[model samples]
Target: MLRDIDPMGDQASIIGGVIEFIKEVQQVLQSLESKKQRKSLSPSPSPSTPKSLHLPAKPNPMGEVGACFNSSLADVEARISGSNVLLKIVCQQIPGQILKIVAVLEKFSFDVLHLNISRMEETVLYSFVIKIGLECQLSLEELATEVQQSFFSEPVFLNEI
Candidate 1:
């Protein structure tokens, strides 16, 4: 329903404004209706996007040179099987600390699976999930202690959780 009926005033301007307003309202209502229709069509929750399960791409040092190499050569020194270790550490708010942590893990012969880093206020939180063979030379406790000692310092707290 349109209101503000004008008799002597500029009818064209008032009518134009009303038309624009109606168009906007119609667009909004159409969007809402479409959303409702979609929801009704999919009463059950849609399956989660497969993209969520994808792990982040790790940096490959060998680059294109290794790409052309034999596939069997890549599997020669593989130690870890299907098991992995998840490590979470909180450290001082600084730069290059994560790189150091990764270097330590590599030094200990642990293959990093997934790593996530976040900052909570003044502290930096790091989560590293690693994979190691059942015959891994270093024990989990030993590795955790070594990592903690390597990264621990004043204003930095390292913990594996």
Candidate 2:
């Protein structure tokens, strides 16, 4: 899970990971579609029929901020210079994701000195310049591993900077 897409690593591996993720998503969509089709085909239902589990759509609380979407999963790159760590993270533009990252940094005793966020159609790129705390004991590799595993259930690509 701590795999890094280093420049020196095989390019095929990265592509393979992306392809695998896409296939899984497609499968889930197809399953949902099939269920919808079956429900529509039945014009009337008896009392014994089980109620559909689908819930009514609700308005997005984030409004404009929640409209963005991304075609790919998350990617992160880490570079260390002296006591400072430079991080470049690209992921879906979801609310509270940045807070999760910040929480991890706090747990590791890293202080964010600067942050730059760029938003496109469906993705966000976060560039962070942070200072390593004097009491921090983890190495750069260990920090990368921790970040890689922080994302809830999505795969993360960690690249070397």
On TM-score, the leading prediction is: 2
Query: What tens-digit string does per-residue lDDT give for candidate 2 at 49-150?
Result: 323332222224432111111112345556665557877666667666777787788899999998877665555667778998988897655665566456
- In candidate 1, stretches whose alpha carbon ends up further than 4 angstroms from where it belongs are 1-82, 133-135, 152-161
- Cα TM-score per model: 0.41, 0.49
**Best-fitting candidate, scored by lDDT:** 2
Residue-wise C-alpha lDDT for candidate 1, range 44-90, written one tens digit per residue? 34233111111222324533111111010010011222366656554
Question: lDDT (CA) for every model shown?
Answer: 0.47, 0.58
Colliding residue pairs in candidate 2: 69-122
Q: After superposition, how far is residue 158 of candidate 1 from its true place, in Å?
A: 21
